[model samples]
Target: MISKFCKEVRQEIFFTWIMWGVVILGIVGVSAASGFEHTVTGAYARGSVRWLLGMDLYSEGMHGFLYLPHAAIFYSPFAVMPAWLGEPLWRVLMIGSFAYGIYALAGELEKRYVANLFTVSSLVALPMVLDSARNGQMTLLLTGLMLLATRDLLRKEYGFMTVWLVLGFALKPLIVVMFMLIGGVYARTMLRLAIGLVVMFVLPMLMASPSYVLAQYVGFIGKSSVATDPYELLYSRFCDVFGMLRAWGMPVNGELQTLVRIFVALAVWGVCYCGRRMWGHHLGACLILTFSICYLMLFNPRTEINTYSMLSVVLGIYVGWAIILNKQTIIGGCLIAFAVMIAFSYEVVHQLTPGREYWLPPLLTCVFTGYVLFLMVFDIRPVVKVDRVSPTQSDMLGVDAEKEAEGLVMTSSVS
Candidate 1:
């Protein structure tokens, strides 16, 4: 009864690998053909060279390097190579890890949710993913690491999760939002996080003088602070919630926006504390990651179109799961529509009026966040079949084994 498309998509693992392998080769081939002068690889390469020279990594005169000193260490191997080899290698790392992360996460979801998700979500999110890959953006790498880390967190492997989280810190300071949200749910995570960050901060001293490394760390703080400030950004248009609001004539003050972000952070913390008990770990991880990525797009001052790749991956997977489960058809349809919008946002942005380039991505992210919040606030046990909860999950969720075996939904109310 299965069609050719369904059979191909359902071919477990090798088929997905073949698909992403083609994607990686295609995108990396383009970057290799075109010199990477216009891509963000320059910033990463420059920082690596500066570290080798014992120079300041975050020099004010030479901008575009907002990452921590650890980032230089991470990229130094590629930086030291010839441009021809190094650029393609870096893209390989970005796109390869991204594809692998999706495969790993999709495998886990298929085991749990019983859906054909890998290719569907990847193809749905490909437009944004391709944009990030072509530009050599760290969002690809960070999203990859976070996707792996999300699996570890759901498995209760805090130590492994902390390792991935700290690696993300070396790329962008905004990763702190995810760290904070995860730390809120797993209180013991803060201890592991503190230890991991210490290791990241101290690891660079081995390459350069301790004093030089320490100074770069200090410079990283000042540089990242400025990098996050909207006033420091060169352009007026942003691809965030505020940008959409400004385009819609509902401008909010910067200070007020900070307060709004803070409020959302607190609300996410509450979700972490309470949402786990209401739903199983499967949906809890979904909500945590969804809220984290949505916040980054809707709240961060410097969000770009490429950053939507991170959001797209998470949303795409959830959309596929919703439709496959056949429990929330309406929300699933909305998510599919938005996924189409995001995939076409780049083509559509240029046709709109100036300064409105920031409109669709964040507006779509805001709508996505609303659906995530709805799932968190309302009881979601009905969405998952009762028999799917493993014994350990039932114990952790405090569900009656006999009742769950009888297909009775857990009636736990959200506090």
Candidate 2:
């Protein structure tokens, strides 16, 4: 078994390294051409500089630093470094973390087809990976943490899950959406995470004065309020539901928007709960994070087009599961085009009509979310357990009669 595992890994990894080498080059190329002042890394590192000088962490506009003061402490290492040095390093760090996330996740469930799954997903994830890496965006880091957190949850390793989830929460508080779902499943861990969050929230005070840190925290609260303000004057447009609606010439009322958010949040939690019950841990955990991230992009008030890069890790793996490794070739292929469309969403937006280009990815994501709910509610299992399957795949596989009948009965029962 060890020898066979080695062979399977060897066959796929032999060629995989070459592809990764290309990815590294792409990151280097983007870094070389990008000015330190222009990249998001510049903004990230600047917060630390501002904090060190005892300036306000949050400023007036979208261009102002928007994260918690703790985020500056997180970026301090990069801030101390020169821009040329920091830019490439930060980019590589995020993209590398994302790649490691893929490696870890693919290894967890399907040892035999690990490379096959890794290759397809990585290839699909590359565009967004490259996009985020170029800009030195932290979306990849958060995405990596999400994948690792999902893997830890599957292993019942709540200790490591707490570390990842807490660090992720400190970096971007919006991931509380994920925390809420995971909290629903693992209540005790959520308590540990809550305490962990308190520790992290105050960790910045050790480096700065308490008054200053407290003021920064207050500023963070004010900054967060603007995230849902559709009327706020900003250079960049939000790519959330508000963006989609406003693009269609239907501005939403604030009260209605809040109600909509609550309703959707409940529905998403229900979908995730049903997924866990219907699919069990192996597949359930992956879908939970996958759908949660999708929800984040569509509903989170300040979601930007490039922020959609957060979907790369999960969506890529899901597409590979659907089109390449999945036994259910029928509905699986449905995501293939979407994978491409989403990965290159930053580019696709330019090709679209000017008025509503930002709506494209979120709109497609809504459809994807509905498709997943359909699959789960119908108990339409993908039925491809990589553990027992041969390493070599045939041209195509069909739905076996027994599984098909089971799916029909489950669908009728739900109806």
Candidate 3:
């Protein structure tokens, strides 16, 4: 048994190393090209770190007036470093942390080739690398923390798990919902997380000035209302429900958007609930679907194309699972294609339609939304449950049944 396990580990490690090499090579190739553009917001985030923190140089411009001052505080450390030093180092660190986190998460559940797939898939697109490098956004970091927290929680590493959850919540407060769900399942850990959040978020606010916290938060929300197409504005794709609506000349009045919000929120909660009940092959699918759907439905209507680059991680999880489980039936392939289209529409908006068309993004986003709903309602489940069967009988079910189960296992392993 020990020898067999070691053999499997060696094979998996070989695949992982190959995948990592390919991705790193791709990233280096892209960076070498002169045509590569940095995102304006990313540039701003990097520059603003100095201005907000009064660290290096005096800042200029109206950009600071729009956001919660507190938000900028997070980036001060990165900003203090010169761009020459900061850019490559920051990007490498984020990519490395994300890869490590992915490896750790996959290992916790004993999934094969997670690190390799994550590294390879993330490298397939230009937008994904740009999102991490340009803005120094917390996407990779947040994802890493979430993955780590999930793994730790599963292992009942309550204290350490809570620490990661708190850090995740600090990075993006919305992830608190996910932490809450995990906490609910593990009551003792949840208490530690809740206390930790109060201390973390509160300490920052208290350190800044009591009014600054509410002011920055309120300021961020207010600024967010003046929505820009992340694709058009940032030169990336915009794929979310709002993208379609805005393109179609539909009113984006937040007050009127309540129904959509409520519907999406409920759907997300439902996915989380289902994730809680599943295990083994079903577990990863449940978690990935829950995270992706919730991310798209609840957080992404106002998202920009560059932001959609982050979704590839979730998509990779699904795809990886599909390969191992042999699950993407002809029908499943079509559905996967549709989901990819929706995701890509936002990430690479230029290919789907001409910029003259405003409605394309929103339309694609809505279609993606509907696609998720369809999968949730009808598509993302077992075709048939396996009953008790002799080992010999189960093994002899022929290619069709064996392939189907394999696909299910792949899908179930990550999400």
Per-model TM values vs. the true structure:
0.88, 0.87, 0.68
**For residues 1-415, what per-residue lDDT tens digits would candidate 3 score against the true structure?**
4355457666866677566555554553454352335533354464355446544221233233343343356556656776555555555655666666666765654332223344333333233445444444566666677777767766667788778877766555545556756654445665787788677757656555566556555645555454432333322224455545655555456544556655755666666556555544245333543464345533454455545544545555544445434445563354355345544553355555566233443454355455545655564642233333333434343223454445433233435
Q: Give candidate 3 regions above 4 Å deviation.
A: 1-18, 21-37, 40-74, 111-136, 174-177, 180-190, 205-238, 248-252, 274-285, 292-294, 297-299, 327-352, 356-414
lDDT, model 3, position 215: 54
lDDT of each prediction vs. the true structure?
0.75, 0.70, 0.51
Considering TM-score, where higher is better, how would the candidates rank from best to worst? 1, 2, 3
lDDT of 3: 0.51
Please give the ranking of all candidate structures by lDDT, highest first, separated by commas: 1, 2, 3
The better candidate by lDDT, 1 or 3, is 1
**C-alpha root-mean-square deviation, candidate 2:** 5.3
- Name the TM-score of candidate 3: 0.68
Better of 1 and 3 by TM-score: 1
Highest lDDT: which candidate? 1
